[model samples]
Target: MYLYPLLIVIAASSYGIVSTIIKLAMQSGFSVSQAVTSQFFFGFCIAICIFIFTNRTKLSFNGVKTLIFAGVFTGLTNIFYGLSLNYLPASLAVVLLFQFTWIGMLISCITKRKFPSRIELISLIILVAGTIPAAGLIHVDLSQLPFQGWLWGLAAALCYSLFLFVNGRATTNMNTSNRLVMVSFFALMMAVFFQSPEVIWNGTLFSEGLWIYGLALGLFGLIIPVYLFTIAVPKVGLSMSSILGATELPIAVMVSVILLNENITSLQMGGIVIIILGMSLPTILNRNMLSITKKSTTLGTK
Candidate 1:
C-alpha cells in the first residue's frame, strides 16, 4: 500500500529537479530549444532502447493509438506552461500550474461521477491553500499581466491533470516499454512541431555538448515520471496520485534555495511545511492502522 504512493512521490521529486536542470542548462548558453526539446528527443531514443530489450507484450493498434493520444496531454502541458511564462512571472505561472492538484481531484470526481472522501476533500483544501504561498504567489499583481497568460497557465494545469488521468488508464496492463515508447514518440513529435530539431540536425548536440543535460533531463523529466505514474496511479487512485504530485513544488523550492542559491522567505518555508503535511494527510491515518496491524500480527506469531 505504502510502496505505490512512495513511487509517485519519487516520480514527483524527479519532476521537481528538472527546473533546476533547465536553469543550469540555460546558464551554460543553451537555447530554450536546446534546453527543452532535448528532453523529448533523448527521451524518445532511450525509450526505444528500453522497448527493444523489454518487448514482451505487444500492444494492439488501438492501444498504441490510445497512448499516442494520451501523450498529447503532457506535451500540451509543457507547451502551454512555456507560453504562460512569456507573459507572466515565473512565480505566477507556477502558482497557476499548481491548480492541477485540485483540478485532478475534480477530474476524478467527474470521471467516477462521485465525490471524494472526507479525508481526500480536506487534503485537497490544504494542498490548494499551501500552493499559493509555496509557489511564492502570495502577493502577485495579477491585475497587470495579460489575460492570455492566465488562460495558458490554467490550460497547462488542466492538461497536466488530464495527463495523469489518461495515462493512469491507458493500457496499464500492456507492455511497459511499449507504452513508454509510444508516449515518448508522440511527445517528441509535439515538441518538434513547436520547437526546432536543430539540436540534432545542426549538430549542436555534439558540438555544444548538450547531450549531458539532455540525458539527465530525459531520465528525470520524462522517463522516470511517466513510467512510475503508469505503474502507481492505477493502484493508488488519481486523487491521491495528484496529492502526492504536489510534492513537486516544495521540492522545487528546496532545490532552488539549496542548489541554485535562490532565497526563500520565511513564509514560503512555512508553506512548504503545510504542503508536506497536506500531502501526507491522506496516508498518515491509514499507515498508523497498518502499523498496529503489523504489531498485532507479530504478537500473534509469538
Candidate 2:
C-alpha cells in the first residue's frame, strides 16, 4: 500500500519535471509532432529493453483488446497535449489539463448515478478558486492569449481525462510492463502517421543536442513514470491514485521556478495550496467516514 502511493508520488513528480523539459525541447526547434513521436519511439525502445532484460522471453501480447484501447487513448492524449503547448505556456497548459479532476468526478456522477460527497463538493469549489491564481488568470492579459490555445488546452484535458478513465477499466488484469509496451507500440504507429519520415531520417527534425534531451525525455518522462503509474494504480485504485497525482501541479510550479527562474506570485502560491487542499479532501473524508462507520459498528456490537 505504501509502496503504491510512493511510486505514484515519484511518477507524478517526474511527469511535472518532464513537462518543463519538453517545453524547452519544443523551444529548441522540435515541432509538436516531432517531439511526441520521438518521445514515444524512444520510450517504446526503453520499455522493450526493460521487458527483455527482466523476463528473458519474448514480450507478451495477451491483452490485445485492452492494449489497443489504452494505446489509442494514450496516443491521442499526448498528441493533443503536445499541440496545446504550442498555444499555451507550460504552466497554463498543465493547469488546464488538471481540470480532469472535475471531469473525472462528473463522469463518475453521470455513469454511476452517484452524488459527490460533501467534502468532494467543497474541494471542487476550492480547486476551481485555486486555479485563478495558479493560471495567473487575474494578472495575465486574456486578450493576449490565443483562442486556439484555449481550445487546444481544453481538448487536451478532455483527452487526458478519457485516457485515465479508459486505462482504469482496461488494466484490470494486465501486467504493467505488457500494458506499457503495447500502448507505446500503438502510440508509435499513430505518431508515425503524423510525422514525416524524411525529416526524421535526415536528422533535420530535431535541434542540436536534442538527441540527449529526447533520450532523457523518453526514459524519464514517458517510460519509467508511466510504468510506475500502471503498477501503482492497480494497488491503490484509481480515485486515490488520481488524488495523489495532484502533486504534479505544485511540483511543476516549483520545477519551473527553480529550473527556468520563473517567478510565482503570492496569489499563485495561495492557489497551489487550495488545489492541494481540494485534491486531499476526498481521500481525507473517505477515511474519516470509514472510521466513523467502523466505530458505530463496534458500539452496536457492544
| Clashing pairs counted in every model | 0, 0
The alpha-carbon RMSD values of the candidates against the true structure, listed in the order shown, are 3.2, 2.6
Please give the lDDT score for candidate 2: 0.72
Off by over 4 Å in 2: 1-6, 170-173, 196-200, 204-207, 234-240, 299-302
lDDT of 2 by residue, 1-302 (tens): 25877887787777777667777777777776767777777878887887777665556677677677667766776777777788888888888777766776676567668776677678777777777787566766668877887787778677656655556664545567777888778867777786543445767545455566667777766776677877776576555566666777788888888877888888889888987887777767777889999999999999
How displaced is residue 115 in candidate 2, in Å?
2.9
Q: Model 1 clash pairs?
A: none
TM-score of each: 0.89, 0.88
In model 1, the worst 10-residue window by lDDT is: 56-65
